[model samples]
Target: MTTKPAIIILSASALAMAARLATELDGEVHGLRKRIGDDAEVTFDDVAAHLVGLFREGRPIVALMAAGAVIRLLAPHLGDKTREPPVIAVAEDGSAVVPLLGGHHGANEMARRIAGLVDGFAAITTVGDIKFGVALDQPPEGWALANPETAKQVMADLVAGASARLEGDAPWLADSALPLSEDGGIALLASDENVNTPVSGLLYRPKRLVLGIGCERGCDPAEVLALAKESLSEAGLSAEAVGLVASIDVKADEAALHHVARHLGCPVRFFDAATLEAEAPRLINPSEIVFSEVGCHGVAEGAALAAVGASGELAAPKRKSRRATCAIGRAPHPFTESDLPGRGRGRLFVVGIGPGSDGWRSPEVSQMVAASTDLVGYSLYLDLLGPLAKGKVRHDFDLGKEEARVRHAMELAGEGRSVALVCSGDAGIYAMATLVFELLDKADGPEGLSDGARRIEIAVSPGISALQAAAARVGAPLGHDFCTISLSDLLTPWEDIKRRVRAAGEGDFVIAFYNPVSKKRRTQLAWARDQLLEHRPASSPVILATNLGREGETIRVVPLGDLNVDDVDMLTVVVVGSSNSSTVATGDGRTWVYTPRGYARKEGTAMTNSFSGDAA
Candidate 1:
């Protein structure tokens, strides 16, 4: 009854008759062969050989076998081959025929063509009658099974002659779509699962899910997935039902997208900024960066809405469902309204002005500062923001005075000013950003001045850390897990510094010495080096960068045993490479640092032994 085309097979004597009939009926005969004659270009033997080879190599094959005894011999020859091309058995007299393997992988179409050759019927076995949904085995090969059991169930239902329904309407879906029926019908859901369907209905929503996130600035995709996963799990959704993923257009070329797509075994679709902007009704509080880039509100709301629409759940009301319960787990970090736009959302951009060069400042950071109304930072940092501070109010203070600066930034932002609290290097690496958050946590601090102050938003943008630039200036001597220690005892005790230095040496971590030897505090650096010598080899490479990237820049690479402690001052950053980090001296007397990639070819037990210590 299906209006699809079919292939027909007939006696060799009847082949001329069938071919002529097909030509007259506006149909063509596509033949197969095992071999090609020298003058013929290709023959029926070549087609048969190609089909057999496809079966042998596990490629999907479409074969039309006549009801004659030839199929019995061919089926056994298909033996031991885990993959078989689809084979449709037809009667030579143009009677009924059924497709066997790789039906959706093009076998059905192939059979239909052949059925016309022999004047037979092609029985397609898939359920959804509209435009037969992709078959279980015929889906893109690399796609992983989000729910193997559900797939199995679908097959069982089909074999039992149950009708299948295609739920949820996606614009990308073909126009011949049909509504899903509740009477034990299978639902063909698009990638996203957010439909407004109620629970207790025959339709079951999947719980195991994946959230695809595309971020502009400041948002880490890894962290976003982690948080979204945690939220879904906490909501009683299984980690498995998340057959859905979400992302913005900017991440179209990101490796992170392929990584997630391959893991979920789902196709990814990107939405333009305008389409997503229409879904921003719920995203009332959007960030300035998000607004400028995505031209909309939060990505989560938009992505979630889009995903739900894809899953055929958009028209269904949000209600409890009973097919299965997926738990939504607690998130490591929760998004707040302040994380939205225009809310006392002050961000701490820890910029690593590489080598203190103007060319190294990122254009994005420049735009952020230009958009700010106030700047909170040390006097040195105030100078760094000079170009962008033409119209902005500057709350500059002295060095070693961070509490006041953090307080003022929060206060200004509380009054609705977009503030940028600056740090010299990466704000997170023992810089001003961490201190700001620590103060923000205190109930009595400036961050908690009033209830109106609660919505102040905060963020940290990574910059070039002092150690990275210092290492590049000297040599590649810092190629291991390294610990940085500030020698100043102003806030931390000297005894603690000595203990940490010894621990770093014992653990074989490369040590980046910060605030190493100030003019007034010369002995601390010597004492720290002495502590390191107790656990590390004396021949370790010790690199010192003085006035790095400034007018009086001096980078020195020396052995740990020959380090001159007195030569180092607060402006100097000292790096002592670990034992694993090798030092090679070039012909020009320059030494470089190098670290091995650990194990490369080891497999099985040998690989286990290599990482066993870390596992413990």
Candidate 2:
């Protein structure tokens, strides 16, 4: 197969599923190594050998296709240093679907993603898997190969009453672990149905949950099930593993959440609209319509949170999602107000320094920085904020040292000082604002930071995330729900990054990619470009911005097919417009881009005015 549309090599059944998904998504798929003879078979080994060659050739691999043998054979080759492509495992009988590796770090995620491409459900069987609602070790992708000794460690931790904090919406869902303390500082809780009672440790009752949910008007059953699965994935818990189902009264009769309830084998309780309306205090951006119609800002989100909070379950970290995979858990004890006593409120501002110029820096941001007594940030980012740093205590650190920076800022803030943790561009868009609140979720971590550390209040001020600056410099490309994906596989693994790229492609959302490529990280951008090619036309516009809002900035708008990989690096930001964003060249060498809002295409629209008193 030439890999037109997308090149996929898998079992016949998987191929069939892929074909169906391509049709549903209005895309195409090409299968490599199709069976030719009667009773012929394509095993995992054949696919692995083909992939090894492909990887060596520096060709992009969206996902791998195999049965059981692929990961085993690929294991030795996939040493600690090398990066593996996304892997999706197919049963010979097509009875089950498995996302075996990189669930979040990327492989398993790829399989689940392919299943999405084919519009098929992956038969996830991991225990405490948030999507399927199973245990962490039981996750399908890693189960076959996870170390025998590691299981003992996990069990030992659980037996010792430690908390397992599931972070993302992966089938292999969960981050690091924290042992529940005997002094009641932290407690342990289960995200699955199989709860084990340890002999001596304190069961940490953490009170937070990240709910991954999808619902339709009046509750379409499938949407509910999808929502439930997503909620489990978001919360890093299993759907069948939930303690209860809290939803709006309208969905009480809705078949899907009910089906999910049955699948979870849990009780479903309907919350009145008033109850949801009253929960506004617990919500960040509660919807009036949702509260009026469904009786809750987030039925699935609220339900998951309520279940965990009431049970004193540990809170999971926050994750980003197109839908509402909100994290709600028990409020940290002594949840003091931001304006408490002598200390300045725990404020987190995602300050955007407006490109590289001091002129573009918002006055509000400057004042806030001046007003703060302590500063926290990457060394380079701190260098940019030097004007506001004249008298403040600086906590400069290297790149990728985010968690420590946040903790120090909080510790400083708790010590009664106004603190500002700085990030370039928009603070909230892929910045420190998120990390501040993530640290606030004391329930989930390698270990809970000291209570004094958790007392800091956090707030996020908006800053420009490179996309806005790049768009304006080129043209109006971000006039819609565009997303920003960092291509750096340092903190986030490449496999997860690829899955997100595929999702963005499938959703047809405009994309602004940060940290697009580096010398050692050449393949990611190419892989991302190849994946985008599957859904978007090769002629789609790509805007490359090097040193945006800074001196020596170079901006180029080119067709996706003609994008030059050499043009990007750590200093560059890549803007890939959605299908709607278009390019038009002027009489000169310059080109301009714009996204149409579709208002011009409306029928029965009149140009003449017919107001209350129109005299012509």
Candidate 3:
């Protein structure tokens, strides 16, 4: 069974039962925020909606709820079986477990595991799964079936106690636990050839080939794709068997190469010049011209061998066109995505988890965190992630130890582990993403580390920024131009911060002040107000939003002159409106702060088609 992390969704009453299963399976527990999930790291307001989202995200769900409830929740979002995420619902009392979806994609196995833990029966429905103890469609990790339609009938034949010859060169299939009848009508053919499936047989395609491509600087994507398809067809190689498309690192970002790979439905892999050159002696046709241009004699041949490793041999030599060349390499064994290193580049996700609230966080941030193997952040930020950090190896540091935290994350990514350097709110805004690039700029490049850490891939997954949350709490105070300046002088100079704040004031821009004040730094907020007062009116709307999207959250708007510096803290994001801003009292006697997008001048002019119907 694939050991992917699971999301355990249970009710308030079943928290105790969930605790045992969650620990056993290393699942993230989710329950109602006010009722259950006190023991869970994350809590939800709507259990069914949250479960639906998690299921779509491909997370293995262990729903400890009624089967009817699980079905009702998933009814609307149920998609193709090929794309559905695994979902298994267990009885609240741990008496019955049902695999509701993605059985072919491991739901059956997950259900069985869950059932065993609860000492209950797993209601497995697939007869082929129970009888032959296998799913033919689910080949071994490195293999795939070319046509699943034929595999269905063959599976039925196996379930009905009929098996014919295991054709081609797959020993595992020959020795399969399937009931063997030497001359039975059913058959399973494993090969890379283009096969026409018979009435009683299935064609299994082994992921054993790598296609290496070399192209001119601006090769046409269509031509490259056509070449790839035609070459595969002429060579009698199934496109499904091509595990990857590889080329030299110089073509790593080549749009044509990527387009061709995408059109062929295979992942693109790249080898550095040095790695490709090392495979020179094995190239069928070495060329001095090609070597001079790309530092490699044969990009197609070298990359193909490198992708498939030492045991692989070239199935076809480089076939040339005016603008592109191609070669095919066959691996001794089938290759899985894990077996092929597309590039030896590690990935680092600099994520912002938002203001410690699951509802306020973005789906992208959640997925990036889930995909990461390691979580790197300040202790508080990691703690805020709750159960999202459950299975990840967390490297937590104190508040100000950002350099250590970021460096540790980069180094972990260098070792080819998917690392998430998490932060609160937007990572680019006064967070770790900028610091990550700064360190990379100073490195001696990838050669600095024995494992080449500088080549580590970095991405920034944005969160619902504090200013955005604060702005939306009231009316749109930031509907017009706005600028943000941090009041903290830890890394930035106080004078520089003041200059930015002054510019915002002079431009009549709405200003959001981050890290406004701490215990020791008391005077900056007051000083900023005085500086802003020089340009604007004293009655300007000042929104003090503290602990946004978190417990004890408070959002209140007061006049600029009434703003108390002592009331602000590092957790607060204070949005000060521009000169055009205004405050209005609603029916409930609550005032809303707003800065018009551009309609302040146009408001009095009015319109002929006004909804209030005052056409004069």
TM-score for predicted model 3 compared with the true structure:
0.81
lDDT of 3 by residue, 222-338 (tens): 778778777788888888888788998767546777787676567777888899898998999888999999898999889888888888888888888779988898988887766
Sort the candidates on lDDT, descending order.
3, 2, 1
Residue 101 displacement (Å), model 2? 69
lDDT of each: 0.52, 0.55, 0.80
Ranking according to TM-score, highest score first = 3, 1, 2
Per-residue lDDT tens digits for candidate 2, residues 305-376, read 443444343344323343333333432221122211112223444465656455456656765675677888
Evaluated at residue 498, the lDDT of candidate 2 is 88
Best by TM-score: 3
Give me candidate 1's TM-score against the actual structure. 0.42
Root-mean-square deviation of candidate 3: 5.8
Task: Give the residue spans of candidate 1 off by over 4 A.
Answer: 1-355, 444-450, 587-589, 597-616
Highest lDDT scorer: 3
On the 0 to 100 scale, the lDDT of residue 218 in model 2 is 51
Give each model's clash number.
66, 52, 0
TM-score of each: 0.42, 0.41, 0.81
